[model samples]
Target: MIPKHTVDRLSNRLTHLKPILSFEIVFIAVFVTLVFFTGGAAAQAPVGGGGGNTSGWETILDNLYNVLYITLQYAGLTILVLGFIVWLSARNNSQRSETGMKLTMGGAAMVVAYFGLGALVSLLEFIAG
Candidate 1:
């Protein structure tokens, strides 16, 4: 049962330290989570012309990239298709049409960029070789 005056005084003292205290708390939490969860038990990266297993950093990164591409492909397609439905249902309204157009264009751009980038990388490799 602390006194109200004492509690008020403590609160006032802590007012100026709130930001730093919050930052330190968040930093510690993230550091602990990353170090314990993801940073531990990680394998070595493939480099320096070493003959080794395929479970190195390159494979890990490629898998991550593939995951990213699949997510983007599905998400973009869903948005674009839903936007078309919404826009078509509200065809008399220009606002809805514009929204649908935006979605379609964005999805098209994502699909194009995905394929374009893959092609560009292959082209560069071919040119280099």
Candidate 2:
């Protein structure tokens, strides 16, 4: 069991971190939005050279999927690293430790979801076929 003093300290640290965490989340959201918009625009823009026949919608979807996949991969890695640092630094605080573990698991889940997307697409294709 964690001591009261450790819990108090961890609470104080979390209070200080709350604003920073909010800002990080907002920043990530904005970055992702920008990536999506820009990627969408680029995907829609006409190519100068003629390419083999392909559906424009399919091309756009592929680009969007790639961008999202890469973004999530990086975000998950970043979250996992941050969670590890927090976990290591909050050894004495059960609350902080739990929060860190949750973050780590969430990040891992994101990465897994990213990879699983391909399988999901394949499954859909098979079903459609």
Candidate 3:
């Protein structure tokens, strides 16, 4: 369980961040709702040499996939390493050890989430199909 102070601190932070967070939430929510409600049938892309439908999509997908995979994996690794260092450097401090442990777990979660996203996409495709 999280401590009361941490919960209160996070609540305060979230309160301060409300406007920006609301804007981001609304921005994504509108598009996401449109996506979910708009597509009614499976559409096939045409094959062509000059600016084909799949060309732009393929490039965008490739770039996005590469960026996410590289960034997530490296960021997770960096966090995990930092957490390990923190854990070892503060071996005598129980609070620091706990913080380090949480950070390490969060890093591991991020890595797992990166790997899991592919499977999640497959699952979504199956369900949507």
- What does the lDDT come to for candidate 2? 0.83
Scored by lDDT, model 1 comes in at: 0.78
For residue 112, give model 2's deviation from the true position in Å.
1.8
How far in Å is the alpha carbon of 10 misplaced in model 2? Answer: 24
Residue lDDT tens for model 1, 16-119: 77465687799999999988887645654456866765657667777887887787788778877877787788758988889888888887777787787678
Off by over 4 Å in 2: 1-54, 125-129
Question: In candidate 3, what are the lDDT values of residues 1-129, reduced to their tens digit?
Answer: 999999999998888864656777999999999789867433444446455456666776878787898898899988988888887888689999988988889888888987898788789879999
**Best prediction by lDDT:** 2
Instruction: Report residue 73 deviation for candidate 2 (angstroms).
Output: 1.6
**Collision pairs in model 1:** none
CA lDDT for candidate 3: 0.82
| C-alpha lDDT of all candidate models, in order | 0.78, 0.83, 0.82
Worst 10 residues of 2 by lDDT: 41-50
RMSD of each: 10.4, 8.5, 11.2
Better by TM-score, candidate 2 or 1: 2
TM values, all candidates: 0.53, 0.55, 0.49
After superposition, candidate 1 runs with Cα above 4 Å error: 1-39, 43-55, 124-129
